[model samples]
Target: MSIELPQRPFFLAPLDRENSGVDFLGLRQANLDMMGEMIPSINNVTSYIRPFSLLSWIYWKFHDLCTEAGIEEATSDDLRLFRERIEVLFTWGASLHETAERIPGISATPPPDQDGVKPLTFDAWGRVQSSTSLIAALWYGPASKTVTGLGFLSPVPGRGGFFRVSRAGAALAQALDNKLREDGERYNRLLGTLDPVEANESDAIALWSLWSPETVEHEEMASFSSALTSEEAIGSNDTLLSRRSTTFALARHHLQEVGAEQSIPKIRRGMCFSVRPDGSNYDVPTTLEECRRKWLTLQMRQLQRLALETLLSWCEDQILRYDVVDTSAMAERFKKSWALTEYGLGEARNLAELIFKLDTKSNSVEDFIRSVNTNDLPDPFSIMAEITEKFRQRDPGFAVPCFFGLLQCASFAGAENAPPNMVQLGSAPRLSLRVLRHRLVGLGDVTVAEAFEYILEAMVISQHFSTAVNRFDGRNQRLRLAIEETGLTALVSSAWVPTVTEDRLAMLLTLSAQSDLVSKNFDGEFFSNGGIKNESI
Candidate 1:
C-alpha cells in the first residue's frame, strides 16, 4: 500500500495581495501530478501502516539523530539535513497515501512495534504538540537560512516564497513593532494620567480609598458627575476626578506597596520635617499637611474607580454566559463537578461563563455588575498577589491554581501568557523524567527493569498522598489504607531507587486510584465512570 501527497498550485492569483490575480489551476494540477509521480519511488513495505504512524517514526528518528549529533543549532548544514529528511519523508508520505488509496484496508494494518520498543500511538492532536515543538526549536536553535527555505511553501508570503518572503520579513518587523507599541501603550495607560502634583499629594488618599471598603462605598456615590463637571470647569485640561480614580486603582494593584516604611523614625521625621536631622532640607513636605497635599495630588491624577468598574462590568456583561462556575439553579446539578476556589481557576470559569452569557443576550455594564457579586470575587491585584505567592511557595497544587487563574484573567483581557510550556506542567516531573532517562541510558546506572520498578514505587507513594484528601467526596479512606499497607514511605526511601521515579509512580497510581473510585461511585454509564473515551487525549 502507498499514498500520494496532495498537489498544490505552483503559482496562483495572489489570494489577498496586490498586483497578482491570475488563476493557476493548471499549475496546481501539475504540482499534484508531480507529487503523484514521486510517490511510488518512496513507497515500501511500511506503506501499509497509517500515514501518521509513519510520521511518528520519522519524527522520533529525527529526534534521535538530533540527540546523537548534539545538534541544538539549526545551522546551514542542519537545515540542509532537515530539508533532505523532510523531502524524503514527504516522498514516503505520498507513497503511503497512494498505497492506502490503492489498498482499501491498508490503514487497518496493526502498526509495527520495534524490538523492546513501546508501540507508539500517533496522537491525532499531536499537531498541536508538533507546532509547539517547532516554535521551541526555532526559538532555541541558532539562526539559519533553512527557515527561509522551510517557509518556501508556507501560506504566508515573505515567510517562505520569493515574492512573499519580504512580506513575511515585514510581518515579523511589524510584529516586533506592534509588541513595542502594546507595551508602550500599557505603560502609558497605567501611568498615563499621572500628574506630578497629584502623584506627590493624593497617593495616600488613593491607597486609603482602595483598601477601605467604607471609603470605596462613599466614593461610589460621591457625585462623580459633580466632580467631573467641576474639574472640567477648572480649565485644568487634566480632570482631577479622573486622576484621583487612577490613584485609587494603582493603590489597589498588588504590585504597589504603600506605607510599608511609615513607622521608621528617621523616615517619619524626615517626612514630617521636610529635612533630615543632619540638616539636609528637602523640597517635599515633612508634615501631615504636606502629606495630605501630596496624597490629594496623587488621588486627583489617578484613574477613577467608577470608570474602571464600569469597564470591568462591561467586559463581564460581554462574557458572562461562558462562566464555568455553578450557573444552574440546582446546586445538585454541579455537586459532582470540580469546585475550584483558587482565584485563577475561578476566574477562568467565570470568564467562560461570561462568554456564554454574552451569547444569550446583549449584556450591558450595569447589568453585569448587578448580576454578580464583585466583592466576593478577588480583584485583579489580589489575584496577581495570589499567583505570586503560590509561585514563591513552589507548591505544584498551589501553582496550578494560580496558573489557571492568571491564564483565565489574561485571556479575558485578550492577552495570552508568554508560552504554553511555561505553565503546561510543573518542572519537577519533567526534570525527574529527564534525569532518570539520562541515568539509565548514559550511565547505565540501573537495569531497564530496575528503572521501571523505581518509577512504579515513586508513583505509588505520590498516589497515596494525592488521594489522602480527596475533594471529590471526602471519602478516600480506602486509598489511604492501601498506601499505608503498601509501605509507600519505605518504598520511597529505598536506597537503590531515585526519588523522582518513586514520585512519578506514586502520582500515576494516585490518578488511577482516583479514576477507579470515581468510576465506582458514579453511574456506570456516566463518562466519569472510568470508561470515558477522550478523542483529544
Candidate 2:
C-alpha cells in the first residue's frame, strides 16, 4: 500500500507556495508610498483620494482656472468634462507658473516651495511629477473607478450625455480590449477541444448546481394561472414567482417554506400558454412537466442574469481602474491572488468586448437589458453562475476576487458599480478597514490580532477623510512634497509575504451586510470585547 501524507492546514501552508502567498503587507506599504506622492500637504489632506477622483479634481480645477483667465468657455453641460477639456486644463495647469494669477489676491505670489501645493503652482517638472503620481495612483487604486472614469454617462438633470477619453485613458481601454481578444481566442481554442453538446451540457450543469440544490423534476414549480385568476390572491405571495434573495440562508429558508417557488412556476406557465380565467387556454400545454421545467428554468435565468450583470459591472469597473498592463508588484499581487481567475479573466474580456461595442454615448441598465436577446433560449446566467461557482471552488486565486465583488456590491447597495462615493451609505471600500476589524483578524497571513490592527491602522492613516469639509481645498503643496520623499518604499519592497487562512470567507456575509460606509456600525464581538472603535468617518 502506498503511504499518503495529510494535507497541511491552510494557515500552515508554506508561505512560498506557488500561488498561495499573501503579500498584503508589501502592498499596503507600496500603497502608502504611493499615497505619499498624492497629497499637496500631510496635515491638510489625506492621500486616500483615488486616481479618477484625482483626475476629476484636476479637470475641474483646470476648468475653473481657465474660465477665470477667459481662455476657455464655460457651459453647464456635464458632457464638457471629457479629455479634450482635461487636456486643455492639464496644459494650462502645467504652465500656470509661467503666467500671473488671474485672481487679484494671489496675483504676484511665487510658487510656494512646498511639497503639497496644487499642480498649477508647480513648474514643468513638478506638473509632470504630479501627473505621473496620479497615474501611479491609478495603477494602485481600486479597479471599479477605472471603468466609470472612462465610460460615457447617460444624460440626467443638469447634464447632457458625456463620453471623454484622455490619450492615456484611451490607451488603457485599448489594452483591455487586446487582453480580451487574447482571452477569447484562448476560450475558443478550449471550446474546440470539447464536444459541443457535452460542453454546453457540462456548462449548464455546473451553473445550475450553484443556483439550486434541487434537481429539475416533471412537476410544475409554481401555480401560474391559479394565483392570477383568483380574486383573493391578486396581491398575495402566490401571484409573484420565486424572488431569489442574494443570501444562501434566506434562499434556503424560502425553499423550506414551500411558498414562492412552488407558486410562481404556475403563473409563468399560465402566461406562456395565455391561459385565461374563462377556463379556455389560448394555447394548449405541450406537457405540464415540460412547462414546469421551462418556468423554473426561466426564473433561474432571470436571477442569474441579474447576478452576472452585477458582477460584470464590478469587474469592468475594476479593470478600468487598474490597467491590464500594470506590472507593479501591488497590481500583480492582487491579480494573482484575487482579481484574475480563469473564468473571471475570461469574463473580464467579455465585459471589455461588450463595453467596447457600445455605440451609444450614453448607456443605462435599460439599454443593457434591451441589448440582450432572451427569447426562447437557455438562460446565459445559469452558465455564468456555474462558471463563477466552478472557479471559486477550484481556483485558490479566486478568493480575493469573490471578496472584492462582495465589497464592491456592498459599497454600491445594488447601484451600478460606478466610482465609489465614500460618504455614501453603502461605500464598502471606505468602510472596509474600519468596519471589518474582528473578522479581518486570523485571515490570510494575518496570524495575530496585532497584524490586523497594524494593517487597519495603516489603511486609515493613508486615507484623506474629512469630517468638516467634503473635499480638499487644493492648496497643500509642502505636505504633498514631504510625503513623496518619505522613503517608506524601500522598507515595503523587502517585507515578508504570508500564507492565507480559510477563515476570511467565514465572515463574507457579515462583511457584505456592513457595506454601508456611512453607518456607525461595529462588529458585535469587537464592540463587546471593548476593542477600539473604527474612527475612520
Q: State TM-scores per candidate.
A: 0.17, 0.19
**Tens-digit per-residue lDDT, 1-537, candidate 1:** 343533873422222322111111111222222212211111111111122122222233333445666766324344333423322222222323332123112232233334532121222112222222212222211110123221111223332211122222232323222322344543233222111111111322322222221111211112111211122222121333333222222221101122121222222123222333334443431212322222221111111111111222211221232222211211222222224443322332433342333212213212221222223233323443443454345332332333223222222222121122211212233212122223223323342223323322332223333433342232212221122332322211111110000101111111212223111112211112222121111
State the lDDT of candidate 2 residue by residue for 357-394, as single tens digits: 33131132222222322221212333334435644454
True-structure lDDT of candidate 2:
0.26
Name the weakest run of 10 consecutive residues (lDDT summed) in model 2: 219-228
Q: Identify the candidate with maximal lDDT.
A: 2
lDDT of 2 at 8: 70
lDDT (Cα atoms) of all candidates against the true structure? 0.24, 0.26
